[model samples]
Target: MNAQDVINFLQDNPSFFEDNPDVLTQITVPHHTGGQAISLTERQVSTLREKLAQVQGKLSELVGFGEENDSISAKVHHLTLSLLIAESFESVSQSLYTHLTEGFAVPHVQLRIWNSILKRPLPEFVEVSEELLFFAADLQRPLCGPVQQAEVQAWFGESAEQLRSWALIPLRRDAQVFGMLALGSEDAQRFFPEMGTLYVERIGDLVSAAVLRHIG
Candidate 1:
């Protein structure tokens, strides 16, 4: 009979193995490694071993990711507590910048605010164009990847030219976006389109809330 017919017969008669147990030991299959033949039992054991190895590998990878995420979450929590304790907008900015640069190893960070009343003039109070304001408003989430807009990159000053990647987070109070936080790195892959933005978005939210408390 044809291979399919034989397979169908074997499936249809599950008791055939019980009826003739010798056939289980006598049947042979090609070894997966390609050098020799193996009995059905040996082949089955080999297949199971390969599957187990794959499952163990995946489990290890998952565990590594879990540990990394836990570390990041702890850092975020610490930063959040620091920001909440900051007495003024300047202190909040300082804390945010310091933690990001020292704790997170971010090379460059820039904060800019527009259309807000500042009690004292700060570098972050620099004028932003209508185009940039519109861009900030349009962002529903943090933008991460290679810096594409020259004006946006210019916000980082002299290092702008060498910055290889960026994460742009729009800072908003209620529904109105009034500021932006730019993070840059020399490594091109530091921020990429495929990377998750959950932590960055939460940072933006925290910064926005803290800054809004000071702005008129």
Candidate 2:
């Protein structure tokens, strides 16, 4: 009979192995590793071992990812505590910059707030164009990738050209976006379109809350 017929027969008769147990031991298959023939039992064992190795490798990778996530969570917690202690707008900005630069090793950061009423004028409260304000308003989440806007890149001053990648997060209070936070790095892969923005979104939420508290 043909291979499919034999397979159909084997599947149809589940008791075929039980009826002739010796056939299982007698059947030989090519060894997966190299130039040798092995019994069907040995080939099955080898396949199982290979699968087990793959599973182990995947488990180890998952554990490593978990550890990395835990470390980042701890850093976020520390930054939140620092923000909590900040008493003024300047202190809040300083805390954000210091934590992001020193704790997270970010190369450059810039913040610009639009349409905010402040008791004292701050550099962050600088005027922004209507286009930028619209762009910020349209963002549903943090934007990550190469800096596409020249005006936004200029906020980094002399380091603007060297900064190859950026992450822009809109600072929102209620339904209005009052500001934007931009982070930059020399490494092109530091920010990418496909990268996850969970932590960055959280940072944005924290910064928006702190900034809103000081706004008049």
Candidate 3:
């Protein structure tokens, strides 16, 4: 639970400790006492208090973490909305790069579109890298960051250090790939199979619609 949640829970359930008076063994019983002796020792109670304090510290950390996560999620949602509002490939790509870097905190990304009928690359192409060009030729749908070192090395040819992780999303209309989005990051573990691809796929759907609207 987050810091606020943990704190609220503790506040509401103060009886959790109070009900178990043996938790606070500060008082000692006489040798010939009429009442039952407490099982917990003074040192044990002190340790429990220390443990509770640690839980409180972790709760505070979770509070901060929850806030950061919320911020990131909001930015991503905004970017997705902007993508839906875009009219052209240029606008979409610009907004996407800006959102990736400024909004989502990603490092770098490249978008490539291949017009099947025209047999030409989009205007955005600035001498496509050999690896990217090859990837496009393969026309893989929804590629994620490589896990193996060899795969990673191949994707990032010469300036591999500049890019760590990447996601290649193919834009298709009627099952034909017309464009691709290549997202890159400096962190190797950013994109993985365990993560959800719903957002990227949604972006792909928009890209595909845009491509058909523009070219068809």
TM agreement with the true structure for every prediction: 0.92, 0.89, 0.55
1 against 3, candidate with superior lDDT? 1
lDDT of 2 by residue, 1-216 (tens): 899999999999999999998998999999877787999988999899999999999999999999989988998999999989999989999999999999989989998887787745767877878989899999999999996898898899999989889999999988799899999999999999999999999999999999888874
- For residue 177, give model 1's deviation from the true position in Å: 0.8
Off by over 4 Å in 1: none
Which pairs, if any, clash in model 1?
none
**What are the lDDT scores of the predictions, listed in order?**
0.90, 0.91, 0.66
RMSD in Å for all candidates: 1.7, 2.1, 10.5
1-216 in candidate 3: lDDT tens per residue? 789997998799988667877655655543333465554464466568889999999999999978976876687678768877888656777887798778767666656566544323444443445565466557555677752334334434565566767777877767666666767777778887566676677667766675565455
lDDT of 1: 0.90
Off by over 4 Å in 3: 1-41, 115-142, 147-158, 172-178, 192-213
Error of 2 at 211 (Å): 0.6
Tens-digit lDDT track for model 1 on 38-111? 89989999999999999999999999999999989998998999999999888999999999998889999999
Question: lDDT winner among the candidates?
Answer: 2
How many steric clashes between backbone atoms does each model show? 0, 0, 1
Candidate 3 residue 43 Cα shift, in angstroms, is: 3.8
Task: Look at candidate 2 and give me any clashing residue pairs.
Answer: none
